[model samples]
Target: MQLIADSGSTKTDWRLIDSKGKISQVKTVGFNPYHQSSEDITERLQKELLPQITAEIETIHFYGAGCFTDLACQTVKDALKNIFPKSKAEVHNDLLAAARALCGHQPGIACIIGTGANSCLYDGNKIMDNIPPLGYIMGDEGSATWLGKQLLNSYFKRWMPKELRPKFEKRFSPSVGDALENVYRQPQANRYLAQFSRFAFHYLKHPWVAKLVYDGFNAFFDKNIVQYTDYQQQPIHFTGGVAFYYANLLRQVANDRGVRVQNILESPIAGLTLFHQGE
Candidate 1:
C-alpha cells in the first residue's frame, strides 16, 4: 500500500492506495503545519491519520503547506516514518500537488486559491519555477482569507453601501469582540475568516462584491504571476476550494489580464490517483 497526502492551510486529504489500482480509504484531517506545533502534528497524526493506515504501507508522499523549507519537510518525513515504520516517506510543498492536478502531463501554470494563494510554472510533469508564495500576511490575494479580510475592512470602515451595512451587521453581528476573538485567538485564523467568503458568494452578483473579486484576482495576477515573462502565452490552471467555487469570477479576472486559464480543479486527489495508476 502507498500513502499520499495533500494538505492545505485548512484541511488535509489522505489517500491509501494499493498496487492493484484500488483505493481503500480517503481521510481528512485539520493539520496545517503553519498553525500547529511539531508536537501537535505528531499527536494528530498518531490519533487521526495513522490509525487509518492498517496495512503495511510501502511509500508515502506528503505534499503539504508549510513544508516548503527543507527542515520542515524532514520533520514531517521523520514523523511519518515513525508512524508507518515500513514506509519510505518523502515530503514536499502542496503547490507541486496542485501543479500535477492542474497540468498533469501537460505544460501550464498552476495556482491555488484557498486560505492562501500560490502559483507556479509547470512544464508537463515537473515545476519549472515557483512564483514566491507570500503566505497570508504579505500577499495571497484572490484567496478566501484575503477576500474576507477585505470585506471586514470595508464593513468596519463604512466603505460598503448603507443598505448593506445592516444586513452585514446582522449576519456577522460585527462587534469588536467577535472580530478580535476570531482573528487572534483561533487556529488557522485565515481559514476562520475565510468562512465569510461564502457569504460574499451569495452577493457576488452585487456590483461591490464583483469589483472586490475582480480586484482580488487582479492583484494576484499582477503581483506574483504577471512577471513570469516566459509563460505569458501559456494556459493557466487553478485548484483549491475557492477557485472551484468562483470559477466564473476567476476566469473573468484572467481574461481581463489578457491571460487564459485552462482548468480549475477543486481537489488534486483525482489527478494524483490518475498519475499513480499510470505509474
Candidate 2:
C-alpha cells in the first residue's frame, strides 16, 4: 500500500492507496515543522493521526510546510520510520508537492494560494526554479494570512462601515492585541492568521473583501511570480484551499499577468491519483 499526505498550516489530508488503486482519505491536524513541537507532532501522529492507516501503509510520501530543509525532512522521516517500521517514508516541502500536483511531467508555472502562498516553474518533470515564499512577515502576498491582516486592519481602523464592521468584530473582534498574541503565543501563527481569512471566504464578493483579495493577489504576483520572466507566458496551474475557494480572483490575477491559467484543483488528491496512475 502507498500513503500520501498533503499538509498545510491548517490541516493535513491523508490518503492511503493500495496497489489496486483503492483509496481512503482522512483529515488530521496540521504539521508544520516551523510551528509544531517535536513532541506535539509525535503525539498527534501517534495518537490522533497515524492510527487511521498505520496498518496499511507500506510506503509514504509527506508533503508539508516546514519540511523544506534536509534536517526538517529527516526529522519527519525518522519519526514516520519509527511508526511504520515496514514502510519507507519520504518527506518534502509543500510547495514542491504543489508543483508536482499541478505540473506533473509538464513544464508550467505552479502556484498555491491558500493560508500562505508560493510559486515555482516546473520544467517537464523537475522544478526548474522557485520564487521564494518568504512566509507571512516578508512575503506571502495573495494569501489568507495577508488578507486576514488586511481585514483586521480595516475593521480596527474603522475603515469598514459600521454595518459590517460591527458584525465582523462580534465574530472575531478584530483586536490587534488578540491577533498578535494568538499568533505569537501559539505553535501555529500561520493557522491563526488563516482562520481570520474565513471572513473573506464567506464574503469575497463584498466590496471590502473583494478589495483585499485583489490587492493580496496582485501583491503575490508582483513579488514572487513576476520574476519568472522566461515562463511568464506559460500556462499556470493552481492548487490549495484558497485557489479552490476563490477561483474568480485567482483567474482575474492570472489574466492580469497575461498568462493562461488552467486547472484550479481544490485538493491535491486528484492530481496525486493521476500522478500515481500515470494519467
Counting only residues 3 or more apart in sequence or on different chains, how many pairs clash (N, Cα, C under 3 Å) in candidate 2? 0
| TM-score of each model, paired residue for residue | 0.90, 0.87
Q: Lowest-lDDT window of 10 residues in candidate 2?
A: 270-279
Tens digit per residue, CA lDDT, model 2, 186-238: 66577777777888877766787887888787787778777886666677888
TM-score of 2: 0.87
Over all chains combined, what TM-score does candidate 1 have? 0.90
Q: Candidate 2, residue 229: CA error in Å?
A: 2.9
lDDT of 1 by residue, 1-279 (tens): 878888765567877788887886566675555566667778878988776766788988888877878888877777777777778888878888888878888888889987789998888878888878676767899899999888888888889888777878878777767887978887567866787777678888788888888899889888877867666788898988788988998899888778888889888877776666555
Each prediction's total of clashing residue pairs, residues at least 3 apart in sequence or on different chains, is 0, 0
As a whole number from 0 to 100, the lDDT of residue 36 in candidate 1 is: 69
Q: Residue 233 deviation, candidate 2, in Å?
A: 2.5
